[model samples]
Target: MKTNRSMIRTALAACGFGVVAMTGAHAADTISVVTFGGAYEAAAKKAWFEPFTAKTGDQFATESYDGGLAKLQAMEQAKNPTWDLIDLETNDAINACDEGLLEKFDKKTLGNTSDFLPGSISECAVAAMVWSTVYAYDTSKLKTAPTTIGDFFDLKKYPGKRGMRKSPKVAMEWALIADGVAPQDVYKTLATPAGVDRAFRKLDTIKPNIVWWEAGAQAPQLLADGAVVMTQAYNGRIDDAVHKDKKPFKVVWDAQVYDYEWWGVPAGAKHGDAARKFIVASTTPQAYADLSKYIAYAPPRKDAIPQIDKARLNDLPTAPANFKRPLQIDAAFWADNADAINKRFQNWLAQ
Candidate 1:
């Protein structure tokens, strides 16, 4: 009987594979990873986690959390960190890094930082994928197609409940875009108090008819169940729903808020070396390309672009036509403004 470790060693021998030696013997056996835990985690498990575990003979465990630095902060403060690696959104990554809750990587450990897309190789994180928030409509239900961000707010023209995330992040940006702010000017306009007020004013128009969703999965379900005629969704989610389930959903790329998801190590992670090794193994060009097989989020490595399925190209935010009007989410702006606007958003919702 061959054990999994024996099998892996045998396979490595057969392939002449040179595994990176892990440090920190106390934490070598296993490392815990934290992520949002849904389809994204499913894709990661298949594309990276399983392979990394098999190759390194290291145990991999996963935990799920809605993203926030508070948990990471608590763990760091208590000297009881649970997660070795965290899959973080750009804003959270910036906030966490700024607070020194995340560990900066040795650029060598993750391979060539230059190979990653601009702004993706940050001080404490490396991007996992390029993703976008775009609104989708079930094609069968729409009498006339909505082409632009503005159409998402035009109730008289496309009458029905609209689904949006309960948070102000993407919704506020969309509101400004709908109110005739140019894509380039979105964050600049949003930096002003008047701009914030204007965005909320725009949202006020759709508030009564809005069905607010709290999770990524809820967006597609909202459209499928007829709870929303249109919903703000992670572009990949809508693409999967349309492709996998044969749903007639169509994504509106106009004013889409595109950003990167990053992989980072918590400041006091026990399995530091293993976590770094896992990240390096998982971000190789092949791994990046393979990720597209399980999810629509495009890889951050430019070289991995051509390796993905050609049929799925148009659905990706990187595709030339789809990117025509995308607003690359300004992480710095969100880091600075999130708390303030969030307070205002809650108060407005109460009103």
Candidate 2:
């Protein structure tokens, strides 16, 4: 409705409500949320955050994923936790949920959860955003080309350079997927010794030729520099890089692994109930769609899809074609085995 982007969030009076100007005697709760960077973060601040603060007079503070996790751990360990809510990816959310560090969040606080995908919503968590990792390559470098994770291992066939996230989640899953374990069975196969070994053995095939990307932002840079011909990158990063950097690239969503994010309320948080309320307020259908414009990922709310047009909306991680060869993460497995698998994955990387 507002054409001027900068004035999009200005507080209003009377017939229209303004950000942080709502009336009533509600307590001014300090709501803290942890999230990742890029468009998703931008969207949250615009659609949900600024308005929530305006409407409820609540203060919202958001921190990044890694920084937030460490801060959360530190806060609880000190017995004077600071954060009200945290947004975490699948494994980290599972870790906190399993460790009893989170409190049960009822519907009133987070609003209706019925519109979300069944597995995306949880007892202590709610889906914040959704996205995936896919095989992306600069067209200029591909001689034979790649269509899937399995192709990443065939250096001898496609044989240029490769880039992949050094993190355990993508590394482990890609290793198994490339090794011929179908997308559905990646988590199941990861729990066994043979399965673990299988992923590594497959990863070893590319270690010599691989560039390790430490940040989600690094993938686009690596591609732009021609550091690696093919990489497993978050879909948004590749999309932005192609659009902004003018690099020639394509996302082969086939054999893609869908990743999810969740918002968790910290147990013993002083203002946790209010924290839940803010999350729901910020994650509405319009907000989720707005977030995707900045982040290029899908939102957790299933209804958000219709907000975008048929052409643009089809770019999402959960789009039918993308989901056809989707890889579902095993949050329980990651929660149970993170410590061990992390160590093993690190050690193998050293070799």
Candidate 3:
């Protein structure tokens, strides 16, 4: 389903920040926020939530989850959503908005639509950061570094167990790219029956050697513990490992699949007004830029780029040298086909 950008802009303009004024009495209510916890949640607390609390005297109750629509769907069906704001992946944001599980946001609250990245704004969500799925290996373990997506699958030359997430999304896309499908043509090819089979066939080559991980924190740990020579992981997780934990991991940016992480309010949020204000405060250009101080992800606002430290720019997914062969995740394609693809993935895993 297409996002109605024009409708969002028009509705937001008419409403303005009047909603903030109307909800002033509820300003100090504690907002419950959820995210994929770990280094990301820590970074957000310093850059977004704490600052908002200090400025507004509002507070936050935080929780973490491995992302999906099931919990949100259950909450909406029960008419008692506990989360005020959520950190959503692009595909989840699209599906949740379409299903009316999220509250419609007013873009006018953010000011200047053109300052944000394209596809950053949706009817029910606002883009929070730009992150990527990348592969990394322990630099000390490998005598020679692997530079491309294809290298991740070459067992003869770089022999070791492989680490992969226990999901099909990025794994399928990476398989197609390694099999020589051009980055731009991945979704187009994956849309066909033969293309899906081709991806699985490629995956079958290394299936026996795969050590599957289900969480963001596990990917880097797999590499650190020498469980796998290389693993597919979130770029920030690898960066955190190398910088924070002093692990010897090196990220391979080739054929990286980049996408946005969004802020979405659940439809029946207990602190909806407070949540809306927090979104606006935390997404200001300065706040967005400040997040990179604690994590490697890039902010979604174009204006935020200038405020970021120049030294940190090279590590971001949007940086020129790192982004050369990037493939943007196809949220619409996943929104349309995730169920069918996931079912096939599960069966493939069992067999």
Candidate 4:
């Protein structure tokens, strides 16, 4: 999707000093925005936060949190919510909306919902980026390169420690895909009891060789340090390591599961008006494009694509070459099944 540069300029111009327009007159001077820290935060500050601040004269108090409901729930229970905006994963946003912990959005305020990739905008959230969980190998270390998702599971052929997230989310999906389940059928197959068993059976084959990682940065570090030959990593992290750090890394995009991260207002936030303004400023085509320049995450809006530098296009998860065999994450499925599957995964991990 390509956005008209003129249209973007007009939209941002209209947003000038509109921080007081949300709930009117009671907006706070400072708003706290929560996000996962690192390159993502840095990009957001440059593209959205700083611009918004400069335009509105509103101060931002930034907070970092792993995407989870624990802190949100605690704030809600205490009836003392502090966070004005949240950067949430699709599943977390869905869950937060369901639990009445997030404020619903007005579609008109965020531009036309149709302009964004389908399934990216919700009643309570608007997409910030489309990112993927892909595996990468150190080219310097691997004698033979892995080309497919199945290759990630081939312990005998690769013959080295595999780096994987400690969580079961993407791991289980990759396992099913490696076991010959088509990307289209992955969720459907996992929905059945037999299929769940089949996925676990595949995962068991390389369990002993797995070196578990819990953070996004750890995956690239693991590869660089030779702690693991290949690791399930966020595509942006691997891209940065290769492009900026010049690490000898290669991403295997086949069968990658890509999904959206959203910007949403927490329910009962003190600075609701300012938060809403920030959301509008941040989701503009210009803002989204600016972010893509700083990080590898794909903007959710179709129009924002054209504004991105062409050289960086191949690194995006949404790039046509990488996206040809993509697996769009089914957040609804995970929201419904995560508890049960996570328990099962924990048990399997212990074994």
Candidate 5:
């Protein structure tokens, strides 16, 4: 049998099929991925990674992270990146690409650019889904439902502790919106010194009553435990709590800040080829549509919208009703201003 295999290899070599034969002889590669954990990770495993593994015979090693560029920068500085692909929020993705921490991706690899939502594809990343950061309250606790962004800050009327993420991004924007900044003027207003001061001042109103949460899972848990009457959270997390756990949470779409979650390849990935292939496979119109079955995040691809289950449409941030008065996150503004803004945010938190 050994002699027959050798003869077969030689014959294949002469016929120009040697590379194909040798490629088939190797075991599949394992792609290492890092993502924001909790329901998002579980949804990706079922909708993206698992199916990709089955199709390509490649395995995946997964890890979770809270969003930031610090870890990716550390890996690059050490000349050692263990992650093949990373799930990045828009601002982080922009920063990573600018710092050369992520591999440059060809937009052509994902097919027609027009099929996706505008600004979804970047030089180093491809958007996976559209998600929103919105405040949710327990329906059982609040008899009169809060209807506006201003209501989130009206503690006198809806007296209770508020749940907010520890970061400055969404919180700052929400502050301005609740202070009466129009949805389109959020970034413009935040760009000024007085605007920044105004936002922090509005935040001061609830500073003592704010329960800071750092993780996506914690937001829903905060509401469930009655630790907060209303909390700022990723829309999908609240959706999962409601549908999966039967929690009585109601998401307020007013002034909801929406952003894209992207798939980015680390600059020094060991399985770069496989990682790119997985991105292509996982972002197909059908694949994007299928993800909605697992989580409420809307697909970034315009074509995928039609494929989504009609029943799940209203739960997505892109739904017509929910999208009204929505504030699309200004990724470019955040990319340029994160460092300075974060410093101020940290100092304010300490005080």
Candidate 6:
């Protein structure tokens, strides 16, 4: 995953506006695409997917995946890419692109993607929604709230079994941030040995308190079951979960790490142009605004945020105040550093 500039340029040159003809008919055929089938997925379908289909007379099938990357890899290897387009977590998108498993994006078809936050849109992928890894706690259990990564690590003062994303990216940054690197310097700190070692050491102190969660939905479920009093979770999932399950989970979006879920077409896809059109359709201001309200992930499209509820809008990771303390993830940075960093992260986790 070490994407050097020369390598990136070479890859881009190799892809050259990669567009392909439609499968059957000319200019009148119904296009096909796939997406995750979740509650939020269903929201996306109702708000945009089905509407796109109806408007264009194209049919789409939304599929659910508990493990999207593994499934995408298997599909790619099998040479049976059933999905034309699929959604991915930030790290997963990077992982797939580095392997050349996703097609280079159709930038010409995208009208105002620059309206998205800088760097959120990539050559092989485009972020569909942005969310946070915030300190979500049961307000009823704690007297005072923890405000920063340092406070979260001080289990003695804010003692509880804590849960975090089992993924390498944010979890490691959080560990480093808690170990004394400032929020702004977290990645710079991880780019070195001593900084990374200090992070693992800090993590070791609470390793026993860790309840590792792999699913986006599992974080809040664990909190509700009292498996952990506090956990780093997706703001939308936690908010919906606590409200639905009658739990006291309240999220304070201070010093949160923002991550995005992306849309990428598989490499050698049969329906590339149609997929790109679908991506443009789905990520538009109108569609993204409606989807954000339901999914709770903020749209990277600047105009999309204003269209959402002003009150709930402030709770999002993209909120102006939240952005002051927040760190915008560098996907390319992670795309390049993933292999080494993840291996070291795994080694630490194994210990």
TM-score per candidate: 0.91, 0.85, 0.92, 0.90, 0.93, 0.82
**Can you write out model 4's per-residue Cα lDDT over 236-281, one digit (the tens) per residue?**
8888788778999999999989999999999999988788888888
| Tens-digit lDDT string for candidate 6 (116-231) | 78777887988788878787888888898877777778879988899887867777777777776778897788778887777778888888898988766788778877889789
Q: Which stretches of candidate 1 lie over 4 Å from their true place?
A: 1-28
lDDT of 4: 0.87
> What is the model-wide C-alpha lDDT for candidate 5?
0.92
Q: Tens digits of per-residue lDDT for model 1 on 1-351?
A: 559878876776677564343222223468899987767788899999888777667787988776778889999899898889999999999999999999988777765667688887888988899899999999899989999999999999999999998899988899998999898998899999899989999999999999988878889999999999999998888877877788999999888899999999999899877888888888888899988888888888988977888887777888888989889889899898889988989999899
lDDT of 3 by residue, 1-351 (tens): 136855665675587634344345255788899998888998999999888876666888999887899999999999999899999999999999999999999999988778888889999999889999999999999999999999999999899999999989999999999999999999999999999999999999999989999878888999999999999999988999989999988999999999999999999899898899888988888998999998999998888898988989999999999999999999999999999999999999999
* Candidate 4 vs. true structure, TM-score: 0.90
| Quality of model 2 by C-alpha lDDT | 0.75
Better of 1 and 3 by lDDT: 3
- Stretch of 10 with least lDDT, candidate 1: 18-27
- Cα lDDT for residue 194, candidate 4: 96
Runs of candidate 3 with Cα error greater than 4 angstroms are 1-27
Clashes of 2: 8
State the C-alpha lDDT per candidate. Answer: 0.87, 0.75, 0.91, 0.87, 0.92, 0.74
Report the C-alpha lDDT of model 2 over 140-211, residue by residue, as the tens digit. Answer: 777655676677778778877888877777688878877788878888888899998888888778889988
Q: Is candidate 1 or candidate 6 better by lDDT?
A: 1
Q: By TM-score, how accurate is candidate 2? A: 0.85
Candidate 1's TM-score: 0.91
Worst 10 residues of 3 by lDDT: 17-26
Query: Which residue pairs clash in candidate 6?
Result: none
- Show model 5 residue runs off by greater than 4 Å: 1-25
Q: Which stretches of candidate 6 lie over 4 Å from their true place?
A: 1-39, 57-60, 64-71, 242-246, 270-273
Q: lDDT (0-100) at residue 286 of candidate 4? A: 75
